[model samples]
Target: MHILILGAAGMVGAKLLQRLARDGQLGGKTITKATLHDVVEPTAPEGCPFPVEAHASDFARPGEAERLIAGRPDVIFHLAAIVSGEAEADFEKGDRINLDGTRMLFDAIRRIEGYTPRVVFTSSIAVFGAPFPEAIGDEFFTTPLTSYGTQKAIGELLLADYTRRGFMDGVGIRLPTICVRPGRPNKAASGFFSNIIREPLNGQEAVLPVSEDVMHWHASPRSAVGFLIHAATIDGERIGPRRNLTMPGVAVTVAEQIEALRRVAGEGVVARIRREPDPTIQRIVAGWPRRFDAKRAEGLGFKAEAGFEEIIRIHIDDELGGRFVA
Candidate 1:
């Protein structure tokens, strides 16, 4: 099988690439080739059994999506997007890349006479706004409060409609805010969720932009990659016309997250967090969903960490080499 991963240089995308290179297969078929795409060149996984091609280009540019789709890869992982904060800050760039880029890719797939590849779109919890239920469910309607969420919501609709028209086998998974994200933080409004824990474990200070009581849904980087793998291989007929589902994750408050960090890495590490609230970030987080009843996705075999502590441990094992600063 041939695979294509958009946003291949991004955190999750890069991890997914490493995973595939290690496994060297998807859905029981051997991977023969892979094409990586991003605004900047992506680093292909080393020692892969298959040929990995990396391309640096704007897929949203006219004719660009078409050029990338010309390969007709068996599975396409669409992970590219301007994150929440950046999207909210730059409306034009967000709409161009997140919304227009998605549509162009879908249209390009339809133009192919006899191709209907599996398309796994990485949507977000941002798709649901405030006034949410105690736990947002699969049946809840999307009422996005931010430009980034609105853009993702639009992409979800397009994925379902295009799949209904038989243009592609689409699965849109609304991922939780990935916690303990590896490496330097980007512009995501949710970055602080990872930062407060990540930096502390590295013996560095981190800013706490929101109050400790602020609650949100979360998952580890490992689970995020697992969601993509299952979405790519799962039976589309089983997913039905909805075509989109909220992924499973742990729900915890900032206070609980800090407690979990203390449990895993000790009080000294947790002490590195310094609270200096930013109303802008707090307001953005205020409009996001806090928890989810993701039974629908769970039933389909999607899984996540049972608690925030487990999530933190997974990060320590995967990225910290199983140890942290005392």
Candidate 2:
């Protein structure tokens, strides 16, 4: 079966691509083709068994989404979006890419003849606004606090509606903040979450933008790829009309993260984190959901790291060559 990935160049998308290349199958079918797309050209997975195509294209532009969907891939993973901070900072750009682009993609699929592909959309926890429940539940209403969250929520709704109409088979999973992210931090206000753990382990000083008491949900990159795969292969009939799902993750505060880092890489690594407050980042992050029940995802067999320490270990194994500065 042919599979298409939008926003296939970002960190998560790249990881998912490598994973697909390694597995070489989805939904019990041997993957014969993989097409990668992004605003910036994506690099196709190397040594892939299937024919791989990487192209530079913006889905928000007219005809691009349709052109990508024209292949009628058996599965579509929509992982592209303007990140939280960028989306909040630039309203129009975020709306265009996150909302319009997604709608266009779904509409294009809906217009297709005798075609209904499994669509795995990468949503965000930001979909739940402030005044949140102690543990956000599967039935929690989406009241997004950020433009990025708003965009994701809208996309989720669209995915549900489109699926309800038999236009597509969709599953939208809201991912948590990925900790110990490899490489330099980007514009995401949540970047500090990974920076604090990632930089310290590399023996570099990382600024802690939020207070240690601040809590948030987290998952490792490896687990994130697993969630995508599970979403792509799971029985959509079991998902019913509520196509979006809040994925399970470890919930911890900045202090807990520090403790986990200390436990994994020692106090020497922990001390490398410098506390420098950024009100902009703090405010944006403050509005994010701190925890989630995610019972549905767990019931559906999706899993994540058991704890923050496990999340740290995953980063060391996957990105740090199982070693770090002592």
Candidate 3:
């Protein structure tokens, strides 16, 4: 099987690339070729078993998506996007890259004759809006408040409609806020979710922009990669016309996360965290769903991290060599 990954340089994309390279197969089929594409050229991971190609192409550019789709990959992981804060800050760029770019990719695939790739789209919890009823279920209506959320919601709709029309096999996995994300924080309003854990582990000060009682959904980077892999390999027949499904994740508050940190690294490490409320961030985060009843995704064989402790442990093991300073 030939695979293509867009946004191949970001955290989740990089993790997916490493996982694919190490395994060298998907759904029990050997990967013969893998192509990585992003706005900037993505560096190929060393010692990839399959033939790997890296391309720098903007999906919004005319003819770019068509050119990329010409190879007719067996599976495509569409992960490129502008994060929440950046999207809200720059509306035009967000719409151009997040919405128009995704549409171009779908249209490009539709134009392909006798080619139906299994598309695994990495959606976001941002698709759901504020005033959530405790836990959001699959039946809940999407009313995104941010431009990024709006774009992902629209993409989900397109995926379902195109799949219903028999144009492609698509699975849109609505991802949770990935916790303990490796490397420096990006523009996402949820960056604090990772910062509070990641920074303290490295013996650095990290800011908590929201209150300790503030709760939100979360998953590990490992689980995010798992979701993408499952989406690529799972039986599309069972997915039916509904191409989108909410992924399951842990529901925890900042206090619970701090407690987990104290359990693992003691009060000294936990003390590194500083609480400084940002109302802008609080408002944006308040509009995000705190929990989900992802029954459909769970029943469909998608799994998530057991809890916040496990999520943090996975981050330490995978990204920090399993070492934490007391």
Candidate 4:
């Protein structure tokens, strides 16, 4: 089996590549090739048993999507997108990359002759609008609040339609905000969520962009990678024509996250966090869903971190060598 990962340089994409390379197989078949594509060339994973190809290409650019799809990979992980903050800030770039790029990729796959790959698209919980119910269910209607959310919701619709037409087998996993992400903060509005814990653990000061009571959905990087792998391997027949499902994750408030930090790194480290609420972030977060029912994903065998404490532990072990307070 051949696997292709777009947005291969992003945090989730990079982690997924490592996971796939380590396994070297999917759906009981040995991986013959792994292709990683992004605007910038992705760093090739070390010790990959199969051939790994890293290419720099923009899917929205002319002929780029077709060229990348030429290999007819059995599994395509479309994890590429401009993040929430950046997308909300830059209208044109976001539309080009998030909305247009997705269409091009799906269209390219649809035109392929006798080729039907399993497209595991990484959607976001942002698909739910502001005025959300206490817990959003599988049947909840999509009413995106941000341009980024709108684009993701649009992508889900396209995936379902494409799958319905028998062009490809699509599984759109609406990911929760991945916490304890391994790396420096980017421009995402949700970056502060990880920063509060990540920075303090590293003995650095981090900002709190919203009130402590602000709640939201979360999952670990490990679980996010697991979702991609499972979506690729799971029986799509059970998924039926829906093609999109909200992934299960822990629901926690910012106060709970701080408590987890205090538990792990002690109160002193947690004290390093400074609170300077930004109303823009508050408004943006206000429209986001705080929790999800995610019954469909759970039934389909997807799992998430038990709690914020476990999430922090995963971060410390995976990225901090299980030691802090230096």
Candidate 5:
């Protein structure tokens, strides 16, 4: 199978690339070729059995999406986007990259004759806005309050409609805020979720821009990649017409998250978190859904870490060499 991965330079995208390179196959089929695309060139995985190509360009530009889709990959993983905070801050950029880019990709695929590739889109839980039920479910309506969320909501609708028209085989997974994200933080409004845990463990001070009482849904990077792989390979017929589903995740308050960090690491590590509230981030996060039922995704074989503590341990194992500075 030939695979194409957009946004392969980002954290989640990079991890997915590494996982695919290590396995050299998806589901059960050997990968004969792979292409990685991002605005900034992504690094090709080393020592791969098959050829790997990395391209850098603004895919939202006219003709760009068509060029990427010309190879007619069997499986397309679309993880590219302007993240939450960045999107909310720059409306036009968000609209162009998140909304127009996705549409262009779908249209490019449609233009091809007899090409129906499996498309796995990485959406966000941000698509669900506030006034949420105790647990947001698959049946709940999307009422996004942020530009980023709005973009993803539109993308989900497009994916379903395109799939219904038989233009492509699409699976959209709405991922939670992936906690303990490795490496330095980006502009995502949800970055603080990972920051408070990651920075403290590294003996660096992290600023908590929101209250301890604040709650949110979370998963580990490991689970995020697993969700994408399952979405790519699962029987699309079982998914039915509801092509987009929320991936399962753990729900916890900031206090609970700090405690989990303390349990996994130590008090000294926890001490590194200094409270310095930022109203902008607080306002943005306030509108996001804090919990999800995600029954549809769970029944569809999607899974995530059971709780915040396990998420911390996974970060240590995967990114911190299985240990931290106590």
Candidate 6:
């Protein structure tokens, strides 16, 4: 099978690339070729059994999407987008990269004759607006308040419609806030969810821009990568016409998260988290969904960390070499 991965330089994209290189296959088939595309050139993985190509290209450009789709890869993992904060702050850039770019990809695929590849789209929980119940259900209506979420909602609709038309086999998974993201924080309004755990674990101070009682759905980097793989490989027919599904994740508050860090590392690590609320981030996060039922994802075989405690351990294992200064 030939595979194409867009946004291959980001955290999740890079991890997915590493996983693919390690296994050298996807969905029980040997990968014959892999193309990695990003706004900037992605690194080509070495020592792979199959040929690998990395390109610096923008899908939003007129002909770029068509060029990327020309070879008709067996599977296409679409993970490119402007994050919520940046998208909300810059409407034009968000629309160009997130909305128009996705449409271009779909249209490019439609232009392909007799090519129906499996597509795994990485969606976000921000698609659901505020006034949520204790848990957001699978049937919850999406009323996105943020531009990023709005773009993803539109993408989900397009994926379903395109799949029904037989242009592509598409699966959209709404991922939770990926906690303990292994890098410097990006411009995401939700970056604090990972920052609180990641920086402190590294013996660096992290600012908490929200209250301790603030709750949100979360998953580990490991679980995020797993969700993408499962969505790519699962039986599309079983997914039915819904096409898009919310992934399962742990529901925990900032207090519970810090407690978990304390348990895993020590009070010193947890103490590194400073409480200095940013009203803008607080307002944005307050408008986001804090929990999810995730029954459909559970039934569909998607999994996540059991709780905040387990999430912390997964981060240590995956990004910290299983050790941290207490």
lDDT of each: 0.93, 0.91, 0.90, 0.90, 0.92, 0.90
Model 2 TM-score on a 0 to 1 scale: 0.97
lDDT by residue (tens digit), candidate 1, 1-326: 99999999999999999999999999999999999999999998778889988999989999999889888899999999998878988999999999999999999999998799999999998888889989898899989888989999999999999999999999999999888899996556788999999999998999999999998999999999999999999999998999999999999999999999888888899999999999999987887889999988999999999999999999999998999888
Per-candidate Cα RMSD to the true structure, in Å, reads 1.2, 1.2, 1.1, 1.3, 1.3, 1.2
Q: Taking the tens digit of each residue's C-alpha lDDT, what string does model 6 give over 207-257? A: 999999999999988899999999989998889999999999999998998
Instruction: List TM-scores for all candidates, in order.
Output: 0.97, 0.97, 0.98, 0.96, 0.97, 0.97
Per-residue lDDT of candidate 3, residues 1-326 (tens digit) = 98999999888998999999999889999999988999888876899899988999777898988888788999999999988878889999999989999999999998877778999998888888887899999999999888899999999999998888878889999999888888986657788999999999998999998999989899999999999999998999998888899999999988999998888888999999998999999987777788999999999999998889999899889998989766
Model 2, 223-269: lDDT tens per residue? Answer: 99999999999998887888899999999999999998888889899
lDDT of 1: 0.93
Off by over 4 Å in 1: none
Model 4, range 72-109, lDDT digits (tens) per residue? 99999999998887898898999999999999999999
Worst 10 residues of 2 by lDDT: 180-189
Which is superior by lDDT, 4 or 5? 5
Q: Extract clashing residue pairs from model 5.
A: none
Q: Which pairs clash inside model 2? A: none
Q: Which segments of model 5 are wrong by more than 4 Å? A: none
Error of 6 at 174 (Å): 0.6
Which window of 10 residues has the lowest lDDT sum in candidate 5?
A: 183-192
Q: Highest lDDT: which candidate?
A: 1
Measured on C-alpha atoms, candidate 6 has an lDDT of 0.90
Task: Give the range where candidate 6 is weakest over 10 consecutive residues by summed lDDT.
Answer: 43-52
